[model samples]
Target: MTAPVSDHYSAPRRSALAATVVALVASVTGCAGTRAPGDEPAPTGQALVIGASLELTGQGSALGTQQEHALRILAAKLDVDGVPVGRTRRPVRLELRDNQSDPTLAARQAGELAGDEGIQALVGGTLPETALALEGVARKRKIPFLSLAPGAAVTGSPDDEGYVFKLTPDDADVARRLAEAVAAQKLRRVAVLAAQGSHGDAGAEALPTALKAAGVRLDRTGRLPATGSDFRAAVRRVATGRPDAVLVWATAPDSGAAAKELRRSGYRGAILFDSGAVAEQTLRGTEASAVEGAYAVHPMSLNGSTLTSIAGSALARRDFMYRYLQEYGEYHGFAPYAADALELVAAAARLADSLDRGRIRAFLETQVVEGMAGWYAFSPSRHGGMEADSLAVFVVSQGAWTRIS
Candidate 1:
């Protein structure tokens, strides 16, 4: 995990730091204006501002809200010890923006954040479309970006500036495992229902290949616009095809609508979903009784669940699925992914040395970060780890998502 020396550098004692307030003005937004490579801008009085964008009020609002709460728990732990393996010249401040589930808005926010003079690094985003949209801006601004989720389209084509880094295994690998899960359930006939978003498109394009390799037959496949008030028509269309299994990848687009519609139509086949669509509380509300025995494949680890179970409150990942349950009285959601994502971000920063975007990105691309999951590593040629073809399939039993792995 050693970072390349060229990528990061610590500041040496500066002449400006000899006294009190020595000011430096930076007017650029979206683009960085740094002191001469050698002229370390003596320690400033302000805390280093970390920028984040979450889909707080949009289709993906659930994840956004949970991640924000999870990050708070992480920040609280930064009291004396920073994020694990954490280091910094000053205290860190997290600044968040809401994309409200709009891809364009998410991109715009990232663009503006990159240009902002006060922000140092970028983190947080639950969708890949937004990640791709913000990719260019991160490159243009020379700011370190830790998407800390999944996707290779953006992280694969990492900028020369090495500003892009991620923390999840690639879908290509996830898709393969998902195909296996489908076959294992004896859901030999498959129908694909994709949302009109980045994640959906990727799953749609990838599933066919994965299923075909697994000797699974496809009955039908269709794409749905990411937006919809109801899914009666779409459900009817897929039902008409009589698929043995329905594979849906909703991403941040929200699949609760379609899931509910399927239930109303009395579709009883195993309804397989991408982890992105199998939201905790949202799915509970959908009442997709037809899919009561449905299965889903997600990128998760044993560590998150273990920790949350052990630590009921004080600094558990994503506020502890257990504590959230205690306070809210009936808690449910995928809190581990968000908490784990932040942990990886802080680790990458430490590995990359001085938080230099270029260096950290390079460090991530080259090093294997041992996370709650198995070893996570990335490279230009291979953007994800863990075979996508072998994701963990879980079934809903007794109102809880139970892993079949």
Candidate 2:
């Protein structure tokens, strides 16, 4: 009882319509295969797609949001400058996927994006664990991949994965910086508070060694699981011994929470927090009184001077600050690491020239681009451009981060 379908077009007309559709698809797909702007692309005329796996929702969401927007700025810059493809008359696309801070989901998202024809390279990162998963896949596929999170086990070690590149300094250097800082104060007894996971484990081990070398003792240590939201229990347990100083290795909120508990416990001694609290918001939650004298270490150039000469005058001392102001109205919420990662990835896209994975890896291995951070030079020999010794001790003053040294 179905009605007959309308067939106004004759057989010849239908054939012409089908042919035209095929031609249109061919033209679009062939866009990047050719260099000329006006010329139609080859059989596969698609733009290069760079895949990013980030924690866009969940505990790491705060950082993930900033990175998402920063990626947009990167896209705009490359499109205008015509760096690797777009500026060169061929366009490359930046594709981002949210991992929500779950390692399992991150791995699944990575697998889906790996083999797509539009995807030329991978930018999976935002955390050490996520980076580890992405690099494992990238290595097997021989695709170039970069990670922003610092993890000692990812690379450099004899049995580590060479296919991975890190933009952030690993815990090895941080341990030394912290040890030196504590040594300067001549503190003998040190209590530890660290979260569970790769960062915590690496730091837990590194700090003890560094402290031992510096002639300090790890009197007592308190460990918490990955999902432990409240830091009171661990902070209280570590407080029993009343060590000279409390060294805490954790993320932003955890740092704030621990800072609160340390103060509540009436501990008047110094507290060394993790570099993750470099963001102002992290410390803002703590009673301004709590973070007043709390100490941590960050790269010297972070708040020391503007890398204007390196990043160009267009991006003066306030390049990042200015960009954030333009978007957020109020300044300081945008994360600088995200911007740094975008710059690194764009540089790779530009220097590599071709979309081939092997060539991109080779070019990135020697990339020495000037970012907001400084001359962010990199080589296969070193994953992090910033030397570990470059740390400048700092403390919270008047609700803002100020250099201590």
Off by over 4 Å in 1: 1-48, 83-89, 148-159, 286-290, 302-333, 373-375, 380-390
lDDT of 2: 0.63
Give the C-alpha miss distance for residue 307 in model 2, angstroms: 7.1
After aligning candidate 2 to the native by TM-score, how far in Å is the CA of 213 from where it should be? 2.4
Give a tens-digit lDDT track for model 2, residues 42-115. Answer: 23224556788887777666556666766665555444423343335435468889988877887777777777
Tens-place lDDT per residue, model 1, 206-248, is 8899899888998877777646556677777887867887887
lDDT of 1 at 324: 49
Q: Name the weakest run of 10 consecutive residues (lDDT summed) in model 1.
A: 21-30
lDDT of each: 0.57, 0.63
